[model samples]
Target: MPITEILSYGFMQRALIAGTLVAVLCAILGVFLVLRRLSLIGDGLAHVTFGSVAVLLLTRVGAQSVSLAAIPLVMLASLGILRLTDKARIYGDTAIGIVSSLGIASGVVLASVAGGFNVDLFSYLFGSILAISPMETWIAAALFLIVLVAIALYYHDLFAIIFDEELARSSGIRVAAINRLLVLLTALTVVLAMKVMGIMLISALLIFPAVTALQVARGFRSTIVIAAVCAVVSVVGGIFVSFVANLPTGGVIVLVNAVLFVAAYAFRRCKE
Candidate 1:
């Protein structure tokens, strides 16, 4: 199928729009998360989302309602994780590991009690981009705008925080509050992107692009720009290729990013 023919379909258009927004959201926030050594937070929150979605599904809530409900629940979980790491004796990675395990176990228990996995649950677990509705597209657009505005407003503070947490705190940047805000943004991004990448592979979107860019880019701003470009290209190219090949959209997109990361790694190695 030609590009024009693909865009001619409404579902394809919605998928592209939503995928692009999700790519941007993941790439931009992912940079800071990588710098802050909080990449696992994405994985942890994704697991939390999986469990939350399962609980909602078990209760017979609509998918859209489950999605909406997952946002606050995931954010609260993100905050709780942060608190555990900061206030308690546990380390960050350990806290994330514990929560991740709990989330997966909860999801499994809920799914088993709900009569095992169904198509609807499978879609959330592995994604169903081609099935996205117009309302989901609108929601994604709104989320994109929110992410863009929030990043724009806090760009400098985030930059400072990313570079040196103690220095940022010394400079009155409210490091604790900003860190929580970053986690909150990440939780929102995870939930929204889960619609495209699913719970199993969503963390790749949050980690791969930024890591790929770091392999090549020399400066922070350049790295961010490159990561966003890599992310958007991966999404658009994956969607197109998946349509032509009849492959899984989420899997194809993550594979595309993986390829990009490998290429970037090779390029960096060659340069060195």
Candidate 2:
């Protein structure tokens, strides 16, 4: 079908909206994830969404509704991992690594239980961004607004903790509560984006644009702003490429981001 024919379908419009919203939020949450040095966790949780999708499928529930319902469960499961790790001696990436393994393991079991060969499983694993619907768009939009408000309300504390946890604690930043909120936000973003990039490439959607921004950004605000722009461009460009090349949108989006980074790096060198 031609692009015009494709646009005639409601799914495509919803997909564009969903992709744009997820890209924006991922770009935002990713800054903190990168700052916290837990980029792998972002990837891991995304894969975890895969498993959760699998489990939800086993229940024979609807795919569109499953995501909204799964958001809280996924958030709780992620938070549970954090709390468990916090109770023990491990901190930082090590803890995330442990939880990631557990989440993936659980997801596999759930997917298997749902059916040994649900074709939808493949789509969930790799993503089917073109199939996004109105509900998914709304979900992403609402979550974006919520995250925006939360960040605004706690900007200073979040910055303090991101910059230095000890200093944040010394300044009475409520580190634990803040950390939980961040994890929850991360999980929420993952759920919304899991549809577009799927479990496999969602983390790239989160991290790469922020990295692209870091190369040219002078400060935190500038970095994130640039990243958001880069992210939107990557998503829109990748989706277009995916439509034309018949490839996965998630992978293409990440590739575009990588290309941008290389371009930025070369351009900076030329100027220097």
Candidate 3:
């Protein structure tokens, strides 16, 4: 479809706006998470998102309300997961695996007990850009702004924590508080992104763009810029391609990001 044709529909316009915001949020949060080797944090939180959303769906709650409700639930889960990883004597990935499995199992049971997959459930799992509404677009915009401002305000502290937690602690940066703040942001970003990337694939959005950027960028600032650019392009291109092909939007977006990562890898290899 032509640009004009795509913009003619209200849903498309809303989806594009929401998707772009989600892309930026995920990309920015992703850089630090990837650097900290905490990429699975997105996956674990997404599973919690899936389970919580399923429970909300079973209760007949509205979509926007469900999204909002998931935020606190996800934040609590994130905190618990972080605490476990930090002090429970368990491997971080092991903690993530346990929580991820529990969340997935709970989601499956909720769906079955609620009489199986409906359009709403399917939409949460796979995503449907055509189903986004104006309200969702607004919410996405607000979250985007919050994420942007928060990241900008704490850029130096976050940078310190990301590279060396002990050094940051010794520097009196309150590493624990910074870690909690980062996890909270990750939880929020995971929930917001689920609408665009789906629970099953949200981690890809949170990791791929940053990793791709890292392949070529020489510095932190350059990596973030490249990641944000790649993320926006992937989201826009995925929406367009999905619209044209009538494919699943989340999967298509992840695929686009994968292709970008591959291209980046090839470019880096050639340069070397």
Candidate 4:
């Protein structure tokens, strides 16, 4: 089908717009996360989202409200990870692992108690981007703008912290506050991204484009731009290709990003 015909459908339009916005958001935040060695944070937050969704379902929250309700829960979990790292003196990965395990376990127990997953829950688990509502598209746009503005405001501090936190702190950067902001933003991105990439594949969306850009990017700003471009391409291409091939949009998007990563790696090797 032609591009115009595919985009003529309302669902397709929503998916394209929402998916692109979410992809760019993930890619931008992902650059910081990957460099900070917090890439797994996305996966951890995603598991929390799964558990939160289960709780919401059991509580009989309306399907339309589940995504909105999940934001605060996941944000709290993100802060919990930070607390574990700070007060408990746990390593970053170890802290993430602890929270991630708990989140998934809670979801499993709750799911079993609820007599198993429902159709709505399954959609969240595996994603249903093609069925994205207009409200969600608006949500995506809002999230994108918020993240963009935050990054602009904290660009220098984020840059400093990414390269050397201790040095950033010495420079009066308030590394702790920046760290919290990063994770909180990441939490929000993870929650919104559940509908685009699903809980299982959300990490790939967060990690792939950033890593791919790193393979070839010349500077930090360039990396962010390149990562965003790669993510946007993956989302747009994934939506169209999945529709044509009758495959899952979330999985296809991840696969597209993986392909981009491989291609980037190959290009880097050839250049070397």
TM-score of each: 0.97, 0.93, 0.97, 0.98
lDDT for each residue of candidate 2 in 50-77, tens digit (9 for 90 to 100) = 6677777887779778788778777976
Residue 222 displacement in candidate 2 (angstroms): 0.3
Give me the runs in candidate 1 sitting further than 4 Å from their true place: none
| Number of clashing residue pairs, candidate 1 | 0
| Sequence-dependent TM-score of model 4 | 0.98
TM-score of 1: 0.97
Instruction: Kindly list the per-residue Cα lDDT of model 4 for residues 142-235, writing each as its tens digit.
Output: 8778878998999999999999988998999999999999999999899889998889999998999999999999988999999999999999
Query: How much is the lDDT of residue 251 in candidate 1?
Result: 92
Ranked candidates (lDDT, high to low):
4, 1, 3, 2
Task: Please report how far candidate 1 places residue 49 from its true position, in Å.
Answer: 0.6
Better of 3 and 4 by TM-score: 4
Report the number of the highest-lDDT candidate: 4
Worst 10 residues of 2 by lDDT: 108-117
Off by over 4 Å in 3: none
lDDT of each: 0.90, 0.81, 0.89, 0.94
Clashing pairs in 3: none
Worst 10 residues of 4 by lDDT: 139-148
